[model samples]
Target: MTQLQKQRILVVDDEQAMRELLTDLFEDAGYEVSTAADSFSMNRALEEKPCALVILDLRLKGEDGLMLARELRKDSSIPIMMLTGKGDETDRILGLELAADDYLMKPFNNRELLARVRAMLRRTTELSLPQIRKEDSYSHQRYSFDHWVLDLTSRELFGPDGAVESLTYAEFGLLEVFVQSPNRALSRDQLLELSRGIEADVFDRTIDVLILRLRRKIEPNPKQPRYIRTERGLGYIFTAAVTQC
Candidate 1:
């Protein structure tokens, strides 16, 4: 790929050896690679370089990577993957909650890492492609649904009373599915594939967690979600009529 077309990757790890290894790997993959040894340096790199992807290690002296990931998600949608050796279910899930796109345990295969990098980049293609047709009922009139107000021209979600809501890249995808299907019952597999962009062999819990989060903001009563409903074994249902003015 030409220099202009190469993906820009930022490697954030305090270990010098690990940083060199990742920088080499990404450069071999025809990417523009940059490195940071800590959060301060990482932020400095981000300010100076236009990074398309970030490979972040979860541990560092004086700062935690999970904390770094949260701060990054607050402003940019740059894809993030967490590298960690800690093996705990709760920690993995919490990393996901903080908006890391994926995680790999230490001693990960290079091939697997490459595959994930490609998948995350491939999702960029959908942003350029034409959106699929939505149900006729989906509209953006004078109203509020969930925590968002409608942005008519852009058709993006806004905060209630007209402020812009800070939605992560994945959260926007989930909202897109609901807007398109409104009032339809979609299975966990369907939600995972349709919204999260995972191809196959997806664990159902991912969709469940996403739904739980979306409900907290969108539903009138999160405990008894009006926009999203559980259909027992059947899956989930979104019940909203989006209308435009």
Candidate 2:
């Protein structure tokens, strides 16, 4: 790729060897790479230069990578791919709920990592493109449901009182899928494919966690979620009536 076309990626890991490995891996894949050993350096790197994606390690030296991911999500919509240990399933699930876009278990294949990074970058680029097909209901449209307004063009959500609600990149994508197909039952596999174009494997549970998080944000009562409801053996459904403008 030409320099103008090369995307930038930030790899945040405490270990030097791991950081170097990832930096080399992504750089060889034709991306501009930056490395940060901790939150301080990570913040500095982000402030100094913007990156297309952030690959965050779940375990950082004396710092909680989950907290860093949450902080990043709160401030920016930048895509985050978490690197996690094999036994950190709870942490991995929590990371997703906190809106990390994707996660890869430790000892992951380098090719798989590159593929995921490409997929994520492609998704983000597609969302930000100025020109989209007008006939595509999911693109450049505003969807209203249960007093909330979702503006796909601006990628923002407005509450009933007209306050802007903060949604991470992953949350927004999943919510968009639901609003576009309101009142339809979507299984975990379908939701995964529709939202992120990933298959349902270990990520089926991740879908459930994301649903729980979305309910907490949009449903008046997450405990008895009126907007998104479970469909018994059929996964979940968006029960709210959505109108598009």
Candidate topping TM-score: 2
- Cα deviation at 22, candidate 1, in Å, is 1.9
- lDDT of model 2 at residue 206? 81
Question: Model 2, stretches more than 4 Å misplaced?
Answer: 131-139, 199-202
Residue 114, model 2: Cα distance from true site in angstroms? 0.8
lDDT of 2 by residue, 19-73 (tens): 9999899988899999999999999999998899999998998999999999998
In the range 1-245, model 1's lDDT, one tens digit per residue, is: 79888878899989999999988888898889999999989999999978878899998878888999999988887788888878766766787777776677788788778777877766644442323322333542333455456443243467656666655556667777777677788888888788766532335566777777677766668998888889898898877766534
Residue range with the least summed lDDT across 10 consecutive positions in model 1: 128-137
TM-score of each: 0.80, 0.90
What is the C-alpha RMSD, rounded to one decimal, of candidate 1? 4.8
Which stretches of model 1 miss by more than 4 angstroms? 125-155, 199-202, 243-245
C-alpha local distance difference test of each model = 0.74, 0.86
TM-score of 2: 0.90
Position 167, candidate 1: lDDT: 56
